[model samples]
Target: MNSDCVFCSLLRDEGAADWIWRGQGASALLPLEDGRLAPGHTLVIADQHAVGVQDVSPAALTQVILLVQQVSVALRDAFGARGVNVLNASGPDSDQSVDHLHFHVVPRWAADGLDTWPGGRSGHRLGTQWPAELRRAVTARQL
Candidate 1:
């Protein structure tokens, strides 16, 4: 494990984390005191060193998604959560605290009272408008 990487340090026991489950190539756990959002809310992280989703392979991405699904189901069942939010911040612009690729499985209850980002347009709509053919081509390439 690299000492410079916080996730790696956590995996190596150099840093402390409230670990829940660990498999061969990943770990699922709650964050420490300063990082936790709510009780039983957790993060599912890739075991190998990956800076972002762009660095993860298709197989690894599949594994991570499956693990996140498992955690979501377990959290909902165990804690009676109304729902769960599976989120990931890919790059620095998206409020990424750590560089490592990880997914947050946060359990949401009616009483928790978290608010989502506002969904209103600004001066103009952002992003390029592509034809269906071009969109299909891009999706195919992503696969």
Candidate 2:
């Protein structure tokens, strides 16, 4: 466990973060910054200390995904949510604040002001052609 990682302490049950579900390789908790998002907004955290999905073991990732699915269903049924948003940020550019990998499961309702596509303003430029190097990278599977 990383000594400075708060998620590691949460996994060790050493923190005050309230757990909604706990598994061998994953756990679910209400995010400290949440309660304003939706009625059932929660975070599914990987049991292992990993910066992102690419850094976690396959077994642990599978466990985390399964828990995410379970929580999504719970949010829908328990909170009467019409839909759910399963979000994850992998790096600083993606707004990942915690070092450990986690999935944010947020319930969605019709009148909620949550914007599903926060980057919707960029849609107008979608018709622009991809750079040659980027096209080659995709074709060569370099990314």
For each candidate in turn, the TM-score is: 0.82, 0.81
Quote the lDDT for 138 in model 1.
Answer: 79
Residue 41 in candidate 1, Cα distance off native in Å: 1.1
In the predicted model 1, the residue pairs found to clash are: none
Q: What is the lDDT, from 0 to 100, of the residue 61 in candidate 2?
A: 94
Candidate 2 whole-model C-alpha lDDT, 0 to 1: 0.85
lDDT of 2 by residue, 107-127 (tens): 999989898667755434443
* Cα lDDT, model 1, residue 64: 80
Per-prediction CA RMSD (Å) = 2.7, 3.6
lDDT of each structure? 0.81, 0.85
Worst 10 residues of 2 by lDDT: 120-129
Off by over 4 Å in 1: 118-137, 140-142
- Residue 52 lDDT in model 2? 94
